[model samples]
Structure formats: C-alpha cells, structure tokens
Target chain A: MTTRLVEGSAVVAEAMVRAGCRFFAGYPMTPFTEVLEHMAESLPRVDGVCINAESELEAVGMVWGAAAAGARAATGSTGQGLSLMQESIAEAAMAGIGFVVLNMARGQGDYFQATRGGGHGDYRTPVLAPSGPAEVTELVADAFELAERWRNPVVVVGDYYMAHTWVDLDVAAAVPDPPPAPDWALDGSSGGTGSAKLVSPLGTTKQRDGVGYDLAAHYDHCAQRRQAMTEGIAPRAECLHTDDADVVLVAYGTMARYAEAVVTACRTEGLRLGLVRPITLWPYPSEIVAEACAETKVVAVYENNAGQMIDDVNLALLGAAPVVGINGFRTDSSAFGIAPDVTVENLTASVQALFEQYG
Target chain B: MYHRRVEREILFTGIGGQGIQLAARTLAEAAIADGRRAQLFSSYGGMMRGGNSDAFLVVADDAITSPPVVGTAWAAVVMHHEHAAGVWPKLTESSLTLINRSVVAAECRPGTGAVVEIDALDIATGLGAPVAASLVLIGALVGATGVVSADALLDSAARVLPSYRAEAAAVNRRALEAGLATTNLGHPAWSRAEVPS
Candidate 1:
C-alpha cells in the first residue's frame, strides 16, 4: 500500500469517509476542530453533509438525528465539550440509535467520562483508544462498524499528541468502503402505514393494536440489548514481553506509545519489564490483560490522568497482581495535556524504579 | 544506549512564521516519497508570528517504534536560535545540527555535534524567493545528511507547497539546489548504510 504523510485528524476523517460516514456535525474545539475542518472539506465532495453545530449539545443531537434516519453520522470535541454532550450521548445509547462519537481530548482526563459514561444511565459507550496514526485508520473503520452492528454509540479517544502527529499510511488499504445502513434504520418509509418505526430512548413505539407504551417493557428490551453488547463486542489490546516480565506497564492512547518505548528499552537492558496497551477501554480487555499479565509481579498503571483507568486495570487484574499507579509526571502545567515529560527517558526511569523496588 | 532502533530522529525549531512546520512536513513527505516511513509531530503557539514552533520527526526504512517525543535526536534544524536552546541539550555527541546563519547568532551553536552554519535567508534572498529560507535550510540539511534525496525533496515541495505559491516552485527548486550545493555529504544519517529489513 502506498502511504501518504498525513495528520491524525486527516487520517480520522479520511478513514471515517472510507468507512461510509455520510453525516458529520461538531462544534469546533481545540484538537477536535481540525477533525471537523477535515470532515467539512472532505464530506461535501462525496455527496455527504458536514454541519458546524452551534454547541456540543447541538452537534450530538444533529448526529443523533442523522443516525436515526439511517446515516452513518458522527460528532466530537474535547473532554469539556464532551461533558456538554453527555446527556444526548446517553439518550442515544438508551434509544439504541447507532452513531460514532469522537473525543480528541485535551489530555487523557476523559477515561472515566468515555468508558463509564458522564450521561446519567447504566449505559456504557464502547471506547477505542488508538496509539498512533496508523492504528487510528483501522480503529476509525472499526468505530463505524461497531456502531452499526451493535446499534449503539461508540467513542474514539485521541489526545493533543496523537491528534497532531502525522504518519505515512494508506487510508484506502486499511479501511474498506462501508456498506449500506442496516434495514432497521428509520427512513420514514413505513410512516402512515400504522407500522411506522419509532426510534426513541424510551424505547420503540408500541403497536397500534396493542397496549400503550410499556416503559418497563422498553427498559427490559434495553437491558437485554446492553447485555448482548457486552457479550458480542470483544475487547482488544497490544501486549509486549508480558509473559515473563515481573513489572508490566499498563497505559492506553498516546501514553501507551511512550510506555511501549520504555518497555522496549528496559527489555534491552535485561530488565524484566513489559507493557499492556488496551485497545478498548469500555470492555476494558479484562480477560486478555489478566491472561497476559498473569506472570507479572507489579502491574503498574501509567495513565496520563490521576488514577482514572487504574480502577479498570485493578478490576481486570482481580487482585491477581499487586497494582500501582504512576502519573505521566506532566512537565506542562498548562492543563492542555502537553506532556513533554512523557518521553521514553522519563518513563523508563519510572518503570525501572518499579523494577528496582518490586523486581 | 541503543537508542533510535531503526529510525533516525530529527528535531526542528524556529519562530512561528519561519515555516519550520512546513519544512519539517516536506522533509517527512520527501522521505515517504523516497520509500521510507516517516512520523512528525509539530507544536505551535497561537501567535501567527514570533511564537514558538517546534517539530519532532522520525524516518525509518521499516516500521517506526520511536515515540514522537524523542529524548535525544540525531539532528536539529534551526531557523532561529531564540527557541533552539531546548533542542540543543537533546542533541547527541555525534549529532549534525544546521543553523541558519542568516538569522541565528554563531554563538548559539550546540555544545555537542558538528555545526553547519548556512546563510539560508541570504541564499533565499539571492534566489529572489525571500520566503523560501526554511526550504533552503531544510534542503541543505538533506544535502548534508542524506535524510532524503534532493530530488525527492523537490517532488515533495511541488506536492505540499500551497497553490498560491505555485509560481514560486522553480525558485524553490533553485533555492533547494543552491542549498544542496552548500554541503558535502560528510555525515549520511548513520554512516549512510542500509538497514536490515
């Protein structure tokens, strides 16, 4: 495959289009603006529509509308903007309307918001955190597919580093063209025919000949759908030297890339260190992590934020291993998440210290 | 220390308007155009001019594992030295650093590494393409380092340069050629040797 050097935002947009996303709506926010800009530039040429919504709430609502009408649609912003869109996201999840949600987060602070849902509900948005531009291509494609297949919102997270980093990759080769929307999608075809489809968070419309809207019944169906989603979607991860290493570093997104470099460097020095990079944050890849980290002594959780995903890693480990928490020790205090301190040198020191104390 | 496994890392720094971002991107594109894998991360401030703009790039003949933030780089390409001190400490002992003498003070040289001082602005002025100083400096870097071939750089320039600057493509080529002629390939990016596939 021929590779063209492209920014991660362009790769996401191109990959989304290649995955058949026809409708895009987003309010411009730092890190998320470029993705919207790319989508606005690309979508129109391919007979698609891109809307610059007034606010994050509007953007998510717009995507929900498009998705309800059987269009592969998406909206995005950073963690702050995502906070505003949470209510709509939960409603979409409850309604079983499928759409992709992009969070080019300021930092890794949104781990809890992404996997656990900031919106009030027991619903969970399947979260995908790609480490680099190349992986983003495949993950973006997968985001759309998972959204359509499971009929639920899927979240893809990136950060300042991942958003700006450009890599040589072929978008066409990695992502196949998306197929038509599913038959269950609403297109107003059955309207006025007494069998009109109702796509609502409260659940589908009750049949005209049957009893009125059964809210409990709707919730029962949603409960089953949630359970089915948990069973159907498989969690994924990238493991390195975890089999025999005594110290394992667990990180995701761009932080994982730096952790991988540290893991490799420590391995070169005969240090028994390894890494567990979660590709999916929602399902948490618990079983895979538990199996891969089975032989480890210390499962060090290295998240950019303060102990967000550590809980998940702890849950995944099931206390099989001693778990510790490490921050990126961010040198940039701007809170914009510019972690120059996230270099391999700093991380290697941190990981080596774990080996020194625990190994 | 066995740093930089299969890739060569290059760091670029300059003021906001010096075209450091474009130059770094062009160099990366040129590397890919010449059949190498490249990764670049550019950070810039809000100011349109005179703000800090730094870029970290890695080019490899195979899959690249080095993170975008390199603790030590193989080289540094500096357009202005005001913001280059941060990168100077990150340069290795054998690193090849290029400073645009036209704007940067000679005393701003890195503590380690061989320094090549070029009158990039002067060269661009001589070529009548005054805005092409960054391109000239990058071209001279490729000429000296062989990070990418001059021809590939020219092709990448044609592809990446804005449409409004299309008329200046020939001048860019001339500027690149002039910069290339300034250096003799003393250091060829890790002995100019082939990597094991």
Candidate 2:
C-alpha cells in the first residue's frame, strides 16, 4: 500500500474499494462527481462494476440490485441528487439490504438529511462525518463495515471542502477484510431450485416458505436491530481543552477542523474555549458533547448551514447550558456551495466575539 | 530546529489559464515526494479561462488538522492581481507573498508580509515557455522557501501536467531553472517529523 496525493472523493473511493465495495453507481454532480469517476476507474480493475447511471434514481436502483446479489454496493450524490433516492434508500433500509450512501452534501445543510434521514418510517443509517481526506481513509472503511455488519444502509457525509481537498493517503489498512458470500444473497444459484429465497421489504418470504408472514414481527425485528445498532456502535469524537473550558463549541464535517484549530489557538491566548467534533454524527456523540460542556458557560454550534446541527447540540446539552449558533464564517456563495473560508481569521474573529460574551 | 508543527498554508491566486492550478499541485506533490504530508483545496469559476482560480495548501510533518480554505496563510503566490486582493486579508506579518511582476502592478502587492517580486511571465516569455510562468513561480517558491527541492519540483511537474505535454518537458524545465536562478533558498516553513524535543 502506498500513499497517493489525491482528493477526498478519490480517497473515499479508494477506501470503499479497500473495504471490498465491489459495485458502485452514481450520477454526476459537482462535488460528488469525482467519487463516481474514481469508482468507475478503480472498480473495473478489481473485476467490479461501476455505472454512471442516467439519474440518481437509476443509480440507487442499480445499487439495490447489486447489493441483493451479494455485491458490496454503493451509490452517492450531493444532497440535491440524493433527494431523489430517499424512497429506495428507505426501502433498502427496511428490506435490510446493506449498502453505502455517499452524501457529498452542499454544505452542513444535510445534517438532518443524513442523521435524521429523508426516508420514511423508523429506519436509521449510521452517519459518519469525516473532517477531510485523511479521515476519509478511515471513516469510509468504517461506513462499509457498519453497513455490512448491521445489514443496513450507512451514510457518510461530505461537503464541498471535503470533496475538493487533496491528500496522500493509504486507505487499505483501515478496510475490513471482505467476508465470504452468505446464503441469503440472490445470486441466481437458487433460481432453478425449489427453495428460491426472496429478499423482501415485508416479511412475505416467510409466508411463501411455509412460515407465517408477520409484518408486525418484522417491524419489531428491524426496530430492535436499529436499537441494537445505536447501542452497539461506539460514538467517536475529537475533544480539546474541555476540562477547563468556559465555553464549548460543537461542530462537525469540515467546519469542525476550523473549530478545532481555533480552539487550540484560543487556549494558548488564555481563552477558555473547547470543542466537540462528532465523528459519527448519527450516533451523535451526545455523551461527549455534554460531558465536555459540563462546567461550560455556553455551548455554541458553528455549522455551514442555518442552525441545523445546533438542534443536536441542544439535545446533547439538555438545557444544562445555553446553546447558540454562530454560522460558520463564509462568503462567496457559488452554485457548488463551496465553503470558501480558507483561513481561520474569520473563524478567529467569530470565536473571539463568542468568548467576549460567554468565555 | 523544527519544533512548531503548524501547517504552512500557501494560497495561490490567479486567472483560469495562468497555470495557478498546476503551480499549486507542483508545490503539494513536491512536498509529498519529499516525505511530508500535504493537502490541496482548489476553487475556481466555471469559465475555462480568465476567471477566478485559487488553491489552499496545507503542508506539515505533523498530523494535518485540515485547515479550512485558509484565512491568513503563511505564504501566497499571486500570478495575477485580479483575485489577489481577496487573498490579502488572509496574510499576516510572518507571511511571504510572491507576486509576478510582469502581470501584477507594484501597487497591487499585498499589504502585509515580506514581498518577493519575480517577472515570471517575462521570464517565461524569454525562455519561450510563456505558458509555464506558474512553473516559474513554483521555481521562485522552492528558491525562496526550501519547502521542496528544485529536483522534486521538476519530477512532480512531469506528473501533474497533461499527458500530451510530454514533448514540452524540456521547455518547462528551463522555465523552472530560470525562476530558480533569481532567488536563494533558506526560509523554512516546516518542522521535520523527527520526534520533537
């Protein structure tokens, strides 16, 4: 394994390949386009198939078929494109076919979309929000791992910054070895046989197979699985200076890196600022955020969108401390939704202003 | 003497066709080739040419925290002055700003940082490789700050350029050497990954 200087999208593709994602599909969108390009290039080398589907709908449908055939499949697009795939994603989640969804979002606006999910019912996919390309090397592997292990879809959120940033990463180490094919897959080996297994969203297969079909039981089983997944997956986070912090800030995705940098820089100047960056935005790392802000004066959230993750922060805080939202400092809105604040100067000023009031 | 492990952020500002993108890649790939970690974030307009193009680079021996589009970078390469003003807000006292004197007016230099002026376009035109002016700036970058060796820059240049540019390698090499000749290397913007004492 060697390090290649490449972008975050390429890193995600590399990691997914390393984790044995054998089939991929997606439509072309600005930030998410590179992942599809990389997958198209790399998957063919591994005897895997990657398709640039005509639309997001076709992409998700193709992924669903591949996943049912026991191929570790994935489909991705920006949130706008992903909006079209939510119903299939919901069905796949309910049907219990595992796959990966790369939600390279417009900004942090998709926090609710990824964590809460646009899909209907009580289904939930573990959401992993990596800060940049380096983390993509690890978290993408984590994404496939959770998707397969829980037998449910997984969401890995990326923003424009995460999409464009290039880094040298060898992602093979983080990938889990692909397991042998299970008997449950629809590989056509059972087509001529009398015992044709059906992968169904409803528990109708049991009825056809002489076992009574019980829809309530299936719903209960899925709920229990989601519950188990919530309890089973350990929350991941990065914390700094929280022990002595007077003000604690919560952030995730690319904005969290800036928050982390500003937190460290502020501490040296005697500003008691700390930060909680949730690596798993779905499990939400509520405990870490609350514990870090235990004695803090206020907990502020800096997200690229309009105060979305702040709700999660508030729920994590449980009214123990005041919660505020100072939007991630930004300018120059483009069609691509590039979070173009490159330096921490604007972040520093925003952070300083927060400390003046709360710290 | 490399103790402080801060990411040395470098901003590249220019128009679409000025080779700013290639210049940024050269610096980053060169740093990686030299056994350091680097991240390059590029943002540009839709136009194929004569529109805003910029890149944010973070290089360090330590674990990169992945800075946002850099606010106040440690250095900047200004290939053109049109988009240069926005980058000025992202520089400070310790920063270094390299301006292409052939294209950027003397008054258009950034308000802060020790400025290094190079007639990159004129130099490239002189060498008959006018399109490789950004490579000339890359030469100035390596010369002014020993972030990457001149040799590594050349190797990386060969990789980042379009495959069709294979025949133009020698001309690009001359452009880099010309830019290298105009400055000396000494300023260190990084820490060696050796265990910090």
The collision pairs in model 1 are none
lDDT tens per residue, model 2, B81-182: 888888888789889988899999777977777888999999999988888998898798878887776777778877776678787778887888888888
lDDT of 1 by residue, A1-359 (tens): 66788888888888788878999999998789999999999898788999999998899999999999889999989988999999999999889998999989877888888888788776878999999787887898899988988889999998888878898876454334457767767886775656887889887887466767788888888888989999898999989998898998899988888888888778778998888899999888999889988988899888887788999888988899999998846645335577766778877888878878887
Give the alpha carbon lDDT tens digit for every residue of B78-151 in model 1: 99987887797788888989899999976788999888889999999988887789889988898888888777
- Candidate 2 retains true contacts at a fraction of 0.74
Query: In order of the candidates, what TM-score does chain B achieve?
Result: 0.92, 0.91
**Stretches of candidate 1 above 4 Å error?**
A171-177, A191-193, A207-212, A331-335, B1-5, B190-197
lDDT of prediction 2? 0.83
Task: Give the C-alpha miss distance for residue A148 in model 1, angstroms.
Answer: 1.6
C-alpha TM-score for every candidate: 0.94, 0.92
**lDDT (0-100) at residue B163 of candidate 2?**
76
